[model samples]
Target: MDELIARVSAAIGVDAGVARTAIGHVLAFLRKELPDGPVAEFMNQMAGAHQAADEASAGGESAGGLLGGLLSGGLMGLATKLNALGLDMGQIQKLGHEVFGYAEGVLGKEKVREIANSVPGLSQFL
Candidate 1:
């Protein structure tokens, strides 16, 4: 995943370090924006939903379950909000993917997801 993120970031011509910081910010924003269902919730969601994904990959359940859950649960709300504001889920997903993809490229999505998901009161940011 680290290599993948780096590969993608390099393809996009962004400073890997800057991309990492941007990912940190995006993770923070996700927490702040979805205070009620922030990173912590995402962490649990990821942990809880691990089995539904493929087990053969090296990234394993935490990446699939925890990170995937966070994306589905937390970002789902974001999609709805954007839709309410005259954007569609596709646009929201695109914007989120761009933002998060950069971040993942920098720091690796799981790393950012783990740290961000551990904080308390992240929901307060919403």
Candidate 2:
């Protein structure tokens, strides 16, 4: 997790704290939105990723899945969620690029691509 934070911080020009928060939010979003599959397996391989996602879940950082109908509530809810974290749409897209690139490095392109395609409105960011 520390290493992921460091890489994201450097890649996105954000501080470790912001990177951590953003990463937590992104991962938590993915965990909630993605079906059980390679993405989940890939997330499982990352140390502390689930913990971060769980923390977001427990803290209601993701609106406690209030957008449940959006599957849950699509990317608008996610954009709103990320916006609350001080990231504009461009920054969020950059974060997506960085995080997805990083995930590809770890989990390979095919699996990461699968993850992106599986989530509604996620491929646009990717």
Candidate 3:
């Protein structure tokens, strides 16, 4: 995860610490946004969201449809984290772009797009 943070930082020319903090905020926000469930549950939610998008896009092209499940309900939590961290929306957006781009590089554009579309701030990258 730290390596992922570092790569994202490099990609977007942000400090590694900033990238790490931003991602930590995202994960923590996800945990808080989810119902009282295991971490695996959130992971499952993310995957299911992606698969749904893949299926929907098979017949026609779409932009953020693949991201719906991810961005469904976590925005407020993510915003709270950013507020606590003293990062404004622009910072959060920049971090999101870097992280999403790096994720895409690793998981392939489609898979990453699917994942990004599901998450809160990440959906903007779409």
Candidate 4:
């Protein structure tokens, strides 16, 4: 998890804290949008991911804004949530690539592809 956070931080040019929060938001969004099986597999494979997802689920800076209320599901909502964490679209895409790349290293390409494909409009991020 720390490796992933570091990679995202360095690659996205954000601090560790911001990268972590963004990761939490993305994981939480996936938990909400994906089926139980794939999400469970991902959570199990990724250490500390459950904690991050839980934190995001509990709500924080990203959940309270007016835009947060307006966007509730799918990729648009995920983008909105991430944007609240101070990432632009390019950074968001880079974050996704780094995260999915990390996931592929841990969980394999097929698993990551399955997870990404399950969500509509998510392929663009990959």
Candidate 5:
């Protein structure tokens, strides 16, 4: 997890904290949008993933007033959340690529491809 965060931070030119929060947001989004079985497996494979997702979920709930309610689901919502973390669209795409690339390294290409394919409008990020 630290390795992944470092990669994202260096590659996307964000600090480690922002990269981590952005990862949390993306993980939280995936947990909500993706199928349970694959997501569960993915989470299991990644160290600190559940922690990140849990933190994101908790933060989202506490912070979820009007804007959170407005951008509550799907790809656009995920984009809005990442944007809130100070990432532009290009950074977000790079983040996604780094994350997916990391996932592929750990979980293999086929599994990662399956996970990516399962979500609508997610391929653009890849």
Candidate 6:
């Protein structure tokens, strides 16, 4: 996860903390939108992954409301979340690539690819 943060930070020209927050927001969004099973399992196994997700969503909005917004707006909601974390769409795409590549290293390329493909709006970034 640290390596991923570093790589994404370098790729997007953001500080490590900003990179981490952005990555957390992206991962949290994915976790919510993806189905149960291996993807969820893998996310859980990764240290700090779930916490990152939780922290990203920790805000004034209720979790259900936030999730509802995400579901209603889809990529737009994702964009909003990423934007709140100080990342633009291009940076979000780059973050997706870096994070997916990091997932590939940790969870195997095929598994990560499968997970990426399963998410509705995620493939564009991949």
Best by TM-score: 5
Model 6 earns a TM-score of 0.82
For candidate 3, what is the TM-score? 0.52
Which consecutive 10 residues in model 1 have the weakest lDDT in total?
A: 48-57
lDDT per residue, candidate 1, 15-90, as tens digits? 5543333233344445554445334344234332122112212222233355443453344533333343344444
RMSD for each model, in Å, please?
Answer: 15.6, 3.1, 12.7, 1.6, 1.5, 3.2
Instruction: Name the runs in model 4 displaced over 4 angstroms.
Output: 60-63
lDDT values of the candidates?
0.40, 0.75, 0.51, 0.83, 0.83, 0.74
Instruction: Work out the TM-score per prediction.
Output: 0.32, 0.82, 0.52, 0.91, 0.91, 0.82
Query: Residues 9-96, candidate 4, lDDT per residue (tens digit)?
Result: 9999999989988998888888888748766787788889989988876774446477786775678877888887889999999999
Candidate 3: give the clashing pairs: 67-117, 67-118, 70-118, 70-119, 71-118
**Tens-digit lDDT string for candidate 2 (1-126):** 787888778876779877787788788788777748876886888898888777655554445355433443567766766666667877888888888887888888898889988886777766
RMSD of 3: 12.7
Candidate 1 TM-score over all chains jointly:
0.32
lDDT of 2: 0.75
Candidate 3, residue 14: the lDDT equals 66
